[model samples]
Target: MAAVTLICRPAGVLPKLSGTCSPVLLAAGPVTVQHRKIHHAVVPKGKGGRSSSSGVAATVFGGTGFLGRYVVNRLGRMGSQVVIPHRCDQYDLMYLRPMGDLGQIIFTEWDARDKESIKRAISHSNVVINLVGREWETSVAKAIVNAIKDPDANGKTYALVGPNRYLLHDLVEYIYALSHRPYLAYPLPRPLYHLIARFFEMNPFEPWTTRDKVDRFHTTDMKYPDLPGLEDLGIIPSSIEQKAIETLRRHRRYRYLDAEIGETKPAKTVSY
Candidate 1:
């Protein structure tokens, strides 16, 4: 049996951190959320996180996404009652079923812009895990969870992040490395990249980010977050260099590349 865990959400002064990290400064109102700190434990695979007894009913917004899955999995293993509210179809949410005990996991159809729908879903639940902060989009889902579980960090916004900045080209290189395929970034002019993106954007089947995204990416600093991060919460963010290779291997398109993780081989069309 897993130990009972407590998660807290607080309302208080936000701490100062490095770099001018900006979000519409939210004035934290009186927060009533209270729970015990969840210490390290296993994330349930098929053996745990199951039960008929009701536990902490936690509502996870954006539960269908990558980070949401991580938080939900942990909560399931811990025997918390997880209520995942999603706008996606049933097929997408079905995978989360095994995370909790038989009746402990729940789902509600809801829309974010509709406050009532949002409120209704979490009304019966006490703890709420907000994973909607995607401005720093490519990172921080799991960090939101660690923040909610921290006590001293009670009520403060936890700005979790990767150790360094990564560009689109850099990520492509890492994916190729996972498959042991040699690859190179053929730098295209800024305007040219935007043109290609726009073409893809026009195709409904191949959506792409707007040019503004490219601008935000270019201006972003590779430095770490100045505020309380993974370290402050006792979590050492995994090494990006190493994790990238492993993570990419799971991708369907690159799964065929049979190189062991971190090992790379020459591309079929390579020059000695």
Candidate 2:
């Protein structure tokens, strides 16, 4: 994993503190500051198309989250019938409802951790996006396995989308063996915490920010033709490169290439 560094600077010079006790001294209280160092990864701009026009029905497992909302919006703009499975019909739906009226977003009650709920969600779509994960308990790999183990009346295609974490690789391989549908992983251009800090204008030097380093993976690297270990976990064959490219192009984020199973590396040696 790679780490992103950030520096913070006071918004203005600290005012000299005045006290009635002894010699005046600078105040040690909290001070307002702004980030000084600026570093960001480049993301390609999406190509213009018939913005509101997708012909496929797509289901999103974790469709009410931050990333899920973004994905749903993008898919809605693309005109795909977007189905989002939610655990509760609470305040979360308030934020998701507007997207639903775009003539594409649909909200349904389903639990990613429950196979029956997953099956019900899949029944209505030909393409599925599994975005479920645990903050601390269950592994994401298990969630994906449970979702794909069974398909609806119309056999569907699935693209597993989530953070480019290690646990997801196992799920990717498992999905490849089970359904042979392409897997999609979104790799943040920089560390996740840094992006969060930039979004919220937080001090990156805070102890909470020092947690974990983040890794970057290109979309082109996610297309594995064969199940690495389940069958033969290795680099995806050259034949699948085009498919990966098309998938990446559709998302307009990054390109997907071949990846070494259990490792994160740019597929420089693999010929496209």
Candidate 3:
């Protein structure tokens, strides 16, 4: 399950720390705002929208990932201040600034493997949403931000799964087909995959088939039961089919040449 950390603070002026320490300003580039104080009460000020204050200072741990970007967008539009921790090029994350009002999005560089760096990234946040996964969708982000604002969701867990599921092998083939590539691959035995993973660990350029990932392919299920989901947060989940073509089109063999209307067969989807 994806873990979301919420540290509740009372409304009004925050008490100063025991010893005198210089206040750390959370700003990116030239964008600046008054020093932020921790608050949980949704004392919304201004006439709403981006310029207003939602009283939420969120540190999105995986802000550069697929789902995190959308979550940041929604949070920005709703007037919430977001702290984005990134290790990638600072330029890559600049596009996210316009999503919120000026100074609403703050970027801090942090290494994920280091505990101290992670602590610094989330130091000023009242909420921390961890969407640290490769496979994600827009609906998941919407649901997450919605949950963050809902007082009832303070300690609840919400499962964010897509509307449909497909076998890994079938999904890979469909993606290749979208890219106009011939599919001629077979899954190797589990033991062989483990051996290959060990070899690739030492290789400079690691491929997608890592041992941990291979283990996940067999262990994780897309559709899980007995948990709250996106619908509970008033969100209708989007299907992967809705975005696959748009997402994979760039990888098409020829950039200008479009595929015939029905060239690729649709992968079988399991509706949950």
Candidate 4:
């Protein structure tokens, strides 16, 4: 009977086997099992806490703004590593350090107009949170933050209007009421409105109240019925009325302590 001997060895060039092999076994060559690369999803470490690692690395643009600070604070408490990009002075960013653990919060200088700086700021992050509220509605900051965590919000643009939409004139009137001031609305002719807008443009330091802004008083931007909104993200839109008194409390003519706060009439809402 012919007996075939097989020498099973690890794949690479390793030292010869210690034991003496039979002539039949020596005839057989070494056999190897190939290795494969394995990938893994990031898993959070330790109990969910500020010091613990949540395994989320996020880059936050405009992290010093009103809405941005709140977003960064929430992200930090969840143990997410946050990268704040800013063009402000180093001193201006000092207060933000305490928002996260010792090494969890990172700050990098970035300019919105500089593409390379923007890329570098977000290069190491797996998530990017932009709090650019220039054209965004600041009242919807809470909704925006919640939307960021929802996977359904991915690749979707959302309109962040409040629960009730009000005309600009009505909003101003509401603010005037909160401040205990009288409001007078005078309709300007189309030609006069354009002339005033031109005059405002010519002012070196244009006043806060501009004609363009005044135009929005009676005008409403057309809403897109096909677009998604705060309601779509499982967030019940918050009414500005709820937060108005507290926000405008200090702006009252009388000091907050001296003033007896009274109920103000709610602004008229326009149904979309």
Candidate 5:
């Protein structure tokens, strides 16, 4: 006889669920039992509280920002309740509701400077994952996943990083191709870049490049960190060439109806 392994989604294969529901379970009959929360413990229908899923309850700060939607979606799909702290209007978050089952994605309004509110947000969580660092989205997510799953990761910290190295010029050219936009990445003096960043800082939502980022780029030699990275956590970091399109799809400047935004007609083939 051959053994079979079944995995239902993108988070990799999960262990077989145990019998006799405990994680919010409602029991009616042997075959009629179902769980309340999604993944943590088995909860039978009727015996358990009415909830969509469980396993981890994640409180994601900056959960409504860029990279946030992706993280929230991933968490929601994995049978976790993502507590999103938002200061934005409720309508802005409406699109994220469908990412998970009912009651699986919670929202709380938070002020960054409020210590008590920060404590309240994390009061029920067992894990703390910070995506606060600028441009820290894709890389950190992989590390957080491993740390959660690997017991060896307990008390250890990892710098979630991509494998590809890119200069500012390199990234700009990639984005130009990926977004199919005519933007140019011009190199500016370090001091001028800092000045521009400081000016833009006045507008909380305005886009600006920070001095820390510029400094880090230099410190990192315009690449991922020297420490063990995503590979250490069993995730192969994506190349900029690979990750650029999907990452910039929504920002594509031109779009023709009835077709995908990022993909234009294939480049013309010329045989010599």
Candidate 6:
């Protein structure tokens, strides 16, 4: 009879494997595999606290004004505690009082024109939003420009309208200047939207498509002094502002202003 040879295979270990394996083998009872999962608690660098989700803090300036009020409302709705510094008292803040109840409004007294006040405001806030524009008939342009440039220089000194036409030219210039800053400015995220709302009223024409009508109505309602009755005149629908805000939300882009202090590097060069 020919001699018979037997090849023995290992019982536990597999011979050769290349691709991924499911149900990895292990010794039977009470096997403890050590796994290290590094969980890094990223703390925001500055005084502005980290967001639980994005880990960033949001700060809003002029949080009591018309646009600011809307911004603060949106921020609060997003569960962000917005810091609003104003020189006026509670009675003066009547418009903003509703926001206070939202539990996201923090009110403090600080003059935007004063550097000390601004510095203080910026200290606790991660983002700095400048919504203090001149609505009165004075040197609003110069005031806003100085505030943007100096970050200090208190007292409302800019003239609203004059040979300067500050609202048109200076406003655009200041916005441009702010765009150059390292940190994102308040209105920069959605500047065109704010500009159109702040500057003009909406008017829609008939025979327009529903999308066009919605767009016209949305743009028009962003301005203050709501005109629901105007819908009858074919200007804008009553829900224009709400619709625009919803549109902005759907895009994950916010038009409100917030600040990140110290994160802003000084401008190397500024041009008029």
**Please, what are the lDDT tens digits per residue for candidate 2 over residues 24-134?**
101122322222221110111234222333333556766676456665655554445667888865776777656533545667787546878766665545345544431
Instruction: Give candidate 4 misplaced runs (Cα > 4 Å).
Output: 1-43, 133-139, 182-222, 249-263
Query: Model 5, 5-26: lDDT tens per residue?
Result: 1111111122443432221101
- Between candidates 2 and 6, the TM-score winner: 2
**Model number with the top lDDT:** 3
Question: After TM-score superposition, what is the CA distance of residue 246 in candidate 3 from its true location, in Å?
Answer: 5.9
Per-prediction CA RMSD (Å): 10.3, 23.9, 7.7, 18.5, 11.9, 28.5
Q: Give lDDT: candidate 2, residue 82.
A: 67
**Candidate 6 ranges with C-alpha deviation above 4 Å:** 1-56, 94-103, 134-272
Q: In model 1, which runs have C-alpha deviations exceeding 4 angstroms?
A: 1-55, 133-142, 175-179, 184-186, 195-226, 245-272
Q: Which stretches of candidate 5 lie over 4 Å from their true place?
A: 1-52, 137-139, 177-185, 202-227, 242-272
Clashes of each: 5, 11, 0, 0, 12, 18
Query: Candidate 4, residues 217-236: lDDT per residue as tens digits?
Result: 56654555566765675667
Whole-model lDDT, model 4: 0.60
Each prediction's TM-score versus the true structure: 0.63, 0.33, 0.71, 0.63, 0.61, 0.31
| Model number with the top TM-score | 3
lDDT of each: 0.54, 0.39, 0.66, 0.60, 0.52, 0.34
lDDT value, residue 94 of candidate 5: 99
What would the TM-score be for candidate 4 when compared with the true structure? Answer: 0.63
| C-alpha RMSD of candidate 3 | 7.7
**Window of ten residues with lowest summed lDDT in model 1:** 18-27
Residue 177 lDDT in candidate 2: 31
